[model samples]
Target chain A: MQSMSSSLNALWNHLSDSPLLYLTLTLIAYQIGLFLYQKSGKKPLVNPVLIAIVLLVAVLLITGTPYDRYFQGAHFLHFLLGPATVALAIPLYRQFEKVRKSALAIAISLLTGSAVSAVSSVLIAWALGGSEQSFLSLAPKSVTTPVSMGITEALGGVPSLTAVLVIITGILGASLGPTVLNIVRVKSWAARGLAIGTAAHGLGTARKLQVNEEAGAFSGLAMGLNALATAILLPIVWYWIF
Target chain B: MLFYLTIILLCQLFGEALVTFFALPVPGPVIGMALMFVGLLIKGSVPDGLSVVGESLLSHMSLLFIPAGVGIMVNAELIQREFVPISVSLVISTLLCIAVTGLLMSWLTRNKSIGGYKE
Candidate 1:
């Protein structure tokens, strides 16, 4: 019995170190999330990122696995975030000429949108007695994942917390943003796309892409522009204000 | 394909170098994105391979967020403590931002008559 137990322990250790188990698990969870998202007819509520997180978290908790160890195997996926962010330039370039017609309007509108979302979120969180750190994370929620995390880090907040909040904000914006725009009587796919993209980033762009090509294009432009603007401006503004 | 990917990675590496050397607050990738955008502009068009690889990577961009999303488990306690404030702020602010942004875009572009947005 002791010898068998020792071999079992060795087997578990080797499996854990290999990275294949958790890596496969992570991909599988995302696939499950994607399958459900498509089955639900691309409903925003069935956000694949959210589902994957929940599934992975449950798995980690059940298996008594530490996050560090799991990340050891899963960081392969994480490493792609930087390259994917760099690739965002392609779509932004594709839409450059289209954005030129109303360049000033789009710039001013997106800048205003970014400020409102960031300031409002921080103020609301603070008013509700949230800790300084959480509110700092909330301030960058309107931006994309990598940039938002960087902003949060600069502001001395939790980067990981900011990432989760960013994703959640994306889901909320994609699902309800159109309704909000509709109630406000905002027409024109360009306006719709810009607003959703400014507030929600890439996921919102994805939704816009599916619903209307024009909206998706504008949304894609908005996301790239907003990411650059907020990443560069927010920290400057934060320090100037504080 | 390999050549395009190497360029992308080189851009990212250079971005990180700038951030470190200058202590820039913005993320390295954002700068890298800007660099790549400028390069594209100078060239006046995207290469077929670059566009293909970039689009392919981006098509499943949501998949990329999964690992970091799972990091939430590590912050479960912080989340519980901040849950109410976080949720309320996210819900109210996202909708409000969308409305405000859309209205602003429409109002500002109302007179332009470009793209038939004359509302």
Candidate 2:
């Protein structure tokens, strides 16, 4: 035990300045999360991503490591998001015929959903006496990270606040989306996928993708389209309103 | 394997270039997905190799989101101050949005003739 401690100390000193430590930690935490999630029979609340993130944050706080430093190492994984997002086309292709049939429905649903979410998100916060800064940040909570963050910045909201809200929105949607859909009796995978994607963005789509390919395809499609829709519409609405 | 990866990356690069040149509001990866979709439409099929690579990447797509998610803790102070409004709005609005959207989509398609017809 003493030798192990000394060796651990030595290894830690050797890699203190490098990115590999956090990178490896992120991966391992995800695996642990996966293990726990699977053990729980895929309970939505027992989300692997949430688990991994909580573990990571706890580790960061415990170690006194700044988020920026950890991000430097985990960036390699983050970079893959771009390529993975691009590859969504594969499922979209496979579901193209099905999607094409409901193109009109998809378009209308996306617009209404995206608009309602944004408007309602802002109004809810404002109604609750939330600050104006919170209002601006909440407006783009349904969109993806980079796009949402950009929108928040353009509108003079706190971009970081928006990013965090976006993630929280995602996690909430991913965890509770199915139950809500069930309560509303939305059985069609396409509608479920669109709803999840529109409201939750990538994280919700990820969960949908795991359950059904048809839903996953639509979820991904919804996510991409919502990104575009929010990007264009939010600015116009922002200017119109304020 | 590499060829498929190359195609994906090349599509992304084109997307970035288009975004830069036109100052498109959309994210590059999203445009890249659109371009890839169009290419697939012309190709008339998903290449087996491409499917393999795409599936591999997507299967673990959730893993890719961690770095950004972890970035959340950086703003714990901001969240803590307005925790009530933020949490309430996020939860209620999100659930309401999904329910409304899903119900609308299903209702719109219930006619079986509008947005449901297929060849």
Which number leads on lDDT? 2
Error of 2 at B88 (Å): 0.3
lDDT of 2 at B66: 88
- Reference-based TM-score, model 1: 0.89
Residues A66-180, model 1: lDDT tens digits: 9889988988878887887788787777767766787998998999998899989988988888999998899989888888888889889999899889988887888888778
Error of 2 at A124 (Å): 1.2
DockQ of candidates 1 onward, in order? 0.58, 0.55
In the range B38-59, model 1's lDDT, one tens digit per residue, is: 9999999999999888877777
Fraction of native contacts (fnat) of each candidate:
0.73, 0.72
TM-scores, one per candidate: 0.89, 0.94
Best by DockQ: 1
Poorly placed runs, candidate 2 (over 4 Å): A1-10, B113-119
True A-B contacts kept by model 2: 0.72
